[model samples]
Structure formats: C-alpha cells, structure tokens
Target: MASQWHSLVSQKIFLARNLLGQLENSNSVPAKEALLQGTIELGLRARKLVLIMIARMYQHQHSQPDSLEALGELIGTHSPEIAELNQLASDGRSWWNHLEQLERHQGNPPMARKTVSSENVIAVAADTGPDRSKQALETTLGAMKHFIDILEDRHSEW
Candidate 1:
C-alpha cells in the first residue's frame, strides 16, 4: 500500500513538472493547448487521490502527525494551481478534457448520481466526511494555488 501511494505521489510530481514544462515551452500550439487543458484534469484527479490518502492517514494518524501535517501543508500550497487549472479547463472545455475523459473511462459505465427517496425529514446528522476532510482539502487547495502561480507567471524565455 505504501508503495502504491508512493507511485501516485511520484506521478503527481511528474505531472506537475510536465505541466510547468508545457506551459513554459510555448513551442507547439497544439501540445500547449492540450497541456493547458490537461492541467486542471490532473489537478482534480490528484486532489481526489490525495484526499483518499489523507483520509487513510487520518486513521490513527496521531502516530505520524509530523508527516501528515507536512503533507497537509504541501497540499494547501498546491490548491490554487488546481483551481486555475480548473478555470483553464472550464474556460472553453476545449477538446482535451473530452478526449482525456473518454480515454480514461474507456467504455466503463458512467458514474450515476443515486437519488434518495427518504420522505422523513428525520433530522440527518451533519456530514462527517466533509468536516473531517476540510483541513486536508484546504491544504491541497493552497498547494494548487501556488502551482497556478508558477504556471501562469510570465517567462522571459517564452
């Protein structure tokens, strides 16, 4: 499991680096366009994956508080990048997201939203999941924001 998570983290780092490269190169329009579009998708996906890892980390995470805390801080610093990527993806939805989504799904069944049929307003307890993950989410968001800054900053060489 640790190795699996390590792989994911490594891949995320690679993706982040690749995004920066693509943004800075500006040599090929089509590739740049694809990178501009893919960045958001990767950000969203990475956020989801990191949340899962963090969620697992939360279980008895007291033992490794320092590492977990560092992870949270890193994620916080990275969030803006994710948001910007999202904005870029939404700016036009171009053709990249579609193509990537299709490739990812690869004919898998589309995810469906299950409707609740509860008629009783039996006061449902407040959400546990969101509250638990809120900090981690904020941390990841911060990281994304920083990444966005790096991606958007003007490069003299470009």
Candidate 2:
C-alpha cells in the first residue's frame, strides 16, 4: 500500500513536469491554454497525494488531512512552500472555474459585472501574462519536488 501511494505520487509529478515542458514550448493560444489547464490540474493532484503520503508515513491518527493547509500542521511543522502551493492551487482553480462560468456579477443590485473572455482569462490566470502563469506552475513543481524529497527521507526511517 505504501509502495502504491509512492508510485502514484511519482507518476503525478512526472505528468506535471511533462505538461510544464509542453507549456513552455507551446506557441499557439489554444495549445497553451490546454497545457496550462493540465499543469494546474496535475499540480493540485500531486499536492494532495503528497499530503496523503505524509499522513500515512507519519502514522497520523486521522490518516488524512482535512485540507492542504492542514498537512504541515498535522506534521508539526510549517512550510512556506506548502502555503505558497496552496495559494497557487487556489488561484489556478478559481481562474479555471471562472473561465468555465464566463461572466460573473457581484452584489444584489449587480454593482459590478465581470465578463471573462479567452484572451483576458489567460491574462487573469497568470496575473498579467503567460510568463506569470509559467512562473506559478514552476513554483508548484518546485514545491512538489521538495515535499517528495521530504517524504522519501521520512519513509527511509521506517
């Protein structure tokens, strides 16, 4: 069971890295969009898997974290990288969900109506442009790598 979880985590990290490579080389708008979405999805999945692995490895009473933010807390350590990853995942998920919804209005009187188009959605996802989105993905990849290393080191102790 432990080995199975390890294998799953490895696969997710590999897939995310592969998607990042494709995203870097993608020049077409549609291709970039698809790659970006894939990267975000993989990053989130990898994070969850890492959290689960950590909980299992440490023999936590709960055996599962309530949320990404709860992982570090459960382990009795605080990691800024984990926090950053959480934020990145949240932002990416929001952007993706927003893209699906297209237009959103706020307030009972509709104080403001925000309409999202493909071009602007991409920009918003990255905070400004593709460069930012790439940076976010890279950050997520780095954090995943860091956690995986920690998981390996801890696993060897048992």
Using lDDT as the measure, which candidate wins?
2
Every model's Cα RMSD, please? 15.7, 8.7
User: Once superposed on the true structure, which residue ranges of model 2 sit more than 4 Å away at CA?
Assistant: 60-62, 69-132
Expressed as tens digits, the lDDT of each residue in 13-81 for candidate 2 is 789778888886888999987887676667657656767776766667457774665877776555543
Off by over 4 Å in 1: 59-158
CA lDDT of every candidate: 0.44, 0.61
Model 1 C-alpha lDDT per residue in residues 1-158, reported as the tens digit of each score: 33354357446645744674556667797866566446544545554554344433334333322232354554453554334434544643322233234335533554564455677445556433221122332334345444323432422124
Task: For candidate 2, give the lDDT.
Answer: 0.61
